[model samples]
Target: MIAGEFYKWTDKKGTVHFTDNYLSIPHEYRHQIKIQKMEETSEKKMEGIAAELLIKKSVNEERKAISDGEKAFNEKCTKCHSLSGKNQDDSATQLVGLLYSDKFKESTLPVSEDSVKRIIKEGGGEDMPSFPEMTDKELNELMRYLIPYLKKK
Candidate 1:
């Protein structure tokens, strides 16, 4: 049936009643009857619910991307780079701090998303090797994981 306005009230017997006619309600129940505009309330509630679900879905997707990124890092980058600065050594670079390190800051490349992605895709000089085989989606997931560790100037 098409949505329309209606009145609802609870009677003395505690039975809830609904009717489209306002005057049909008993005079005593009239004081407590609520006028509900079905179309407006339903549409608004649905919109609110849809927005909430979209936000939740986006959060979940980002979380999954971050998790995937961490996995990729462990599989491909842990040998030469460390996320916790505990693996600082002759061969390993502890990438635990901001991207503003002397190495990155001094380079010709700017500290932006595109630059960072390019650096990752095409090696960062003698020490860093290029990930020529890594897919763009994988690279994006890896970036999501590394974002928390990098602070921009």
Candidate 2:
């Protein structure tokens, strides 16, 4: 049957009937009938649902990445670099200023992201311990978490 067209008529008992065929509807009521369009195709509806699902999945993945990055940073870096600057010792530098320091901003010496990653992986001289066991995915997430603070504008 064709979509979007409707026929309306009153039966002999004066009850109203609605059908899709205009020819089956009594001749007198055809002039007063109005066409009603279908809302959307099943494919279009499914596409909309798919789009919503993709958006939800993307958001969930982003949240998971942020959470994992935070956890990795807390576990791996907090011992040497204090977030609040209250518990930092002389053996390790406070991280709050490391990103904005002249060395980091200029990407000089041991201050760039590549340098930081290498330090995280290989240990920074005698004071820092190596985290060679960290997976590539974990490192990427950790870097993403640090990028906003560490990257020069």
Candidate 3:
């Protein structure tokens, strides 16, 4: 039926009726009738729900990855690279400043993801112990934690 062309009317005995034919509705009650649009189809509604679920799942996964990265950094690097700048012993470096320093940029060590992965696995120097035992996945997580600090000024 064409939208806005349908009619609803109540009879004298209080029974209600709906029809697409304008003639079926009595003249007195015709002014009271109003057409209503159809609601969305189930398929359309389900598609919207599915899209929303996918977006939520992606966001949740990102949050989990970040949390895991922070945990890995704390477990692996905090011993040799102090998170706080103060009170670092001779054996350890203050990591926060080092990440943004020109010296760090000039070093032979590469800072890109794959290069960082190699360095983490092989160790940067004699002063830094090799973490050959760390899996590629764990190294990735640690790198995620450190990459923000390594950004150029």
lDDT of 2 by residue, 45-103 (tens): 54554565477568878778878988999887876675564433342465555656654
> Lowest summed-lDDT stretch of 10 residues in model 1?
85-94
In order, what lDDT does every prediction score? 0.75, 0.66, 0.65
Separately for all candidates shown, the number of backbone clashes (residues 3 or more apart, or on different chains) is 0, 0, 0
Query: In model 1, which regions exceed 4 Å deviation?
Result: 1-41, 86-92
**Lowest-scoring 10 consecutive residues by lDDT in candidate 3?**
36-45
lDDT of 1 by residue, 1-153 (tens): 125666668898897666655766789888997876666567776566456547756897999999999999999998877776553334336665547666667777787777878878998868889998989999999999987776633
Model 3 agreement with the true structure over 31-71: per-residue lDDT tens digits:
77766333433557445545654775688677777789899
| Estimated TM-score for each candidate | 0.66, 0.55, 0.57
Sort by TM-score, top down from the best: 1, 3, 2
Clashing pairs in 2: none
